[model samples]
Target: MNTRSTSRFSRAALPLGIAAVMTLSACGGGSSSGESSGSDTDTSAFSINLDDCEDPASATEPITDTFDIGYSAPLSGPVAGAVELATAGYDARLAAANEAGGIDGVMIEVNYKDDAFAPDKAKANGTEFIQNDGVDALATFGTGALSAMVDDQNAACVPMLYPSSSTADFADIEAFPWTTTILPLATNEAKFLVNLIQERYPDGVSVGVAENPTASGKVQGDAFQEVAKEMDLPIDAVVSDGDPVAAATELKAEGVEVVYHGGVTGTCAAFDSARGRIGYEPELVLKPSNCVNAVEYIAAGNAADGIELGAFGKDPNASENEGDEGVAMYKEQMDAAGVPAEIQGNAVAVSGWTQADLVVNTLEQAAASEEGLTRLGVMMAARDQDYASPMLINGIKWYSTPELLTGIDGFRPIKWVAADEEFVPAGEIISIRP
Candidate 1:
């Protein structure tokens, strides 16, 4: 739909450019502290060499000839259905990269473990990856799992790439230089939703927030409130629990005009059921992707009628994007891998595939550099690189630098049309910053 626009109202609400660069300095001495010194010199291209980095690399250590990375994801939990699809996407891309001879003929290996969506298990898996596997980096998922092991990963100086989380804190380069999250932060997504709210409900509307009753859910819900406050959006209801129907009922009773779900598919579906049962229809928004899928739709039936997905990627089932090369490639790989046609179109799977592609590109860039490919070099490659996934909406190029840690800055709001069983772009892609 190519309707992407810079959010005007929220830009005034949040920090911009250099002023935005200082938000995480308290954590790990942001390497861009020097560039933010109000210099007249052109500092946009400044490279970060933070003095407080936890595990400084030796200048003389030659880059390793081969690389081994670890992947920690929940493969046997309630989320396993989506996690397996994501892993399938990852495996598909990794197979393609390896078949192409792998970054200057330096073979790449991956170690995988199922943490069962348990934080304690995830920590144990991270320990094994660090101590026994000696992986150069890791790809992880689950908010709880990542939260439990991020500090451990940082202490080991093992860069964790693209965990399936949108928590703004994960992008704090100063505190967690070894960590990089792939999803757009919830705060940023809030800006787009706010713009939509202002447009559709011009007179101003009260918003309600629903969370999953977990530590991470509370963190995300609080961040949404903070951003909503910044934008002067009134929040009339805040519900946190496992039963989304009850939460939705509470919001409905409050006469809220819009509901922002800061939870997963189950909760979102529950809200839909509650709305349908009570005949209360409000503008609903789910964030950072993976909130709903085919299974959820089938379960909720017409309950999912007008649900909106806030995401940074292309709608895999969008009819307009049928010929997209990346989507085509994804289908072909899934077919080759024997993935069910139904699950192959899953957005979570596509995101996993995209994440793997990004990692491969970073490794390729690092391997090509004269500095060669070491753990530090991999981190350097990931920092500030501008890359576009063919599968992303409008071909949006995701960017990150030492000073700016958020990998994505915007999202394309999509509405689920249950009749057609597809998600279509509802508006032009909206950016949080200019």
Candidate 2:
């Protein structure tokens, strides 16, 4: 069933560190499925009361056959180049899974759309997918757009699963139980960065963040600000987008030692190159995971050298993985699918593969559960997920709990090797310590 169509897709940072298990505010609200409608069962660790909102698709008929999943992303926008590579990785994994006989013999079907990264468009696409298409599960991109439509998703009682902006509101399980994130949450990234910096420069170090106006960027900068305050590291500057060169100049004048970055794609190379142009070599310069792409460095030129990015385990460049079994499977499948060599080996592409791993594993559990292929069943499997993701690095495993919703306990730090134009492990996995 090739049901592809057209369409679209807030996190505040939580307390710092992987050890800070969130005591969600939405705990014990009501029914996790629309089948029970208004039943307020406090038994499950995560739940959503259908009575709070309306969407008949929540009780979507049991899928004893093909399981339809809807996926949406910014297929037509400024970051479309990066988006394309990510999509390639996702599609490749789906192909391999389908070839392997799929979940419980039920093949997965995907309906696709290009949201252009806009909120209104994403909201419209989501409504169509949940209500009209009657898809059993959903996955999407665009943080601001998705955050605006949480009510619509939660009301339908469908599992809005997989990769997207890991916003604060989405992870508040008590409130949005149907939503599960695959990307690195800002809070986790903040904790890891702060810890790594402090661990390396014990005495102290002045830090600065290159900020942007996007929802993801705002939240990223906010998270860094929050963690820095808690750790007592003075921030030299919180420079916004539009003038990376001038921003670099300002940060240098402020005596900023690390030109760390926060924001979506393009921002990394921009700021890193800006510093390079003026020969302002801060002790260290790094980027958040979302911007971990070597091709983007073309604009940043030589400045991209020495830039490190926080990864959620998987490094896109296969060379860095060498003998990893999971990564080997990924490369074999991606190669068989004929995905472009460069695209198949990119960080964004592996992120897509990782998202597929989350969904495939969740579907397997749902098919075996008593609930069986229903929206709530998927949610249950995702909530209790305790497994390894094929694409992660440094033995990172995927897990979920009442405290951790994303299944990611820490961020794997990978650095760019400018000479080889690839990203490799720069240090040990800096875990989120209590």
Candidate 3:
């Protein structure tokens, strides 16, 4: 089983005052502006100090005379292992690009910061990246961190691509022009779960949601409720912050047939601990982030039996992905990085690669200018671009539509078959209605 450890990108003790001042200066007198025109026009008419990381001159010099991207994620905290896998994936993609001569003779320079999945640290890192590093865009992971920096991301006009968040709020392009999500929103996953439950237990099955009290948790819980209502399924209970054993026992007492979990590993541990005490393990439906790999759940042994999950991508261990192109590439990269095969289902890695692809594709579409890359130029180029590559998941096409800024929809339903130790696809890919 893979260990759950802290991330490497732990919070820094630096004061944020300097970063705040730099952020203001980067935004051109702190005024919001509309999207730029999609022409080859030189939008660099106005200039701001692009240096602050080291000496002012070092800042002006492009990290590699090409595009520079900054990434923030929990590389050290409780979810460190997960974040590390994601970083590895991004590194693998960059390695491949560098070997191939990079994007149009310009190498992608990735500056990484560890947030430990903390919101304040994420904000501080975002400020630092925007102000000091002067990155072309911000790429990150974790729902809590991304949610906290929504305002700052929008204000700066910096294109934030593929932060590993699947919340519906991040999908709103009108509100968050610069923000785009790589994973399908929790609402879409919830809807797919509801449909599966209806098909499996059609006699109005009893459903329950075990969620955290955070904004992301509430959104997932609400999505579950909405889907249940639409499908006319009876929701037995919605538990928050209670004892997992006690809650599961109570739900079992109420004859709850299905349980939907919207929390993280700790919550999974809690639920697993309570399984024996409750005397029954209801069908478990977990959110994507919580169900990326089987190690955690498999550690629970019989407790995780009959557990089902909705995923936006394929699990690396699944038989369906065996010998596939994307999975093969992923395995090669992991081997080169010396990452254990057991922990290969790191969704963050896939997300990181996707983000890198998006950046490269966008840069490919934009015209080279002495003024360099503009926000509008990159965005407009990304709007119509598509990648015809194989995804880790079989039978699931990974791309974005015009309705959503990020070219990704929801995922196919997958069942955790402990007997085979793989996540078997439940059915065909389901389209998410925006």
Q: How much lDDT does candidate 1 score?
A: 0.67
Q: What is the C-alpha RMSD of each candidate to the true structure, in Å?
A: 10.4, 8.5, 8.9
TM-score of model number 3: 0.77
lDDT of 3 at 250: 72
lDDT of each: 0.67, 0.69, 0.59
lDDT of 3 by residue, 271-344 (tens): 75576555766755555444554556666666666566765555566565677766677667667756666555
Model 2 per-residue lDDT tens digits across residues 313-359: 56645566678777778888899878877777677788877788777
lDDT tens readout by residue for model 1, 236-340? 889874776687779888988788777653334666776678777876655535574656765677877777866677656668778977677767766776777
Best by TM-score: 2
Give the candidates in order of lDDT, highest first: 2, 1, 3
TM-score each candidate.
Answer: 0.84, 0.86, 0.77
Ranked by TM-score, the better of candidates 2 and 3 is 2
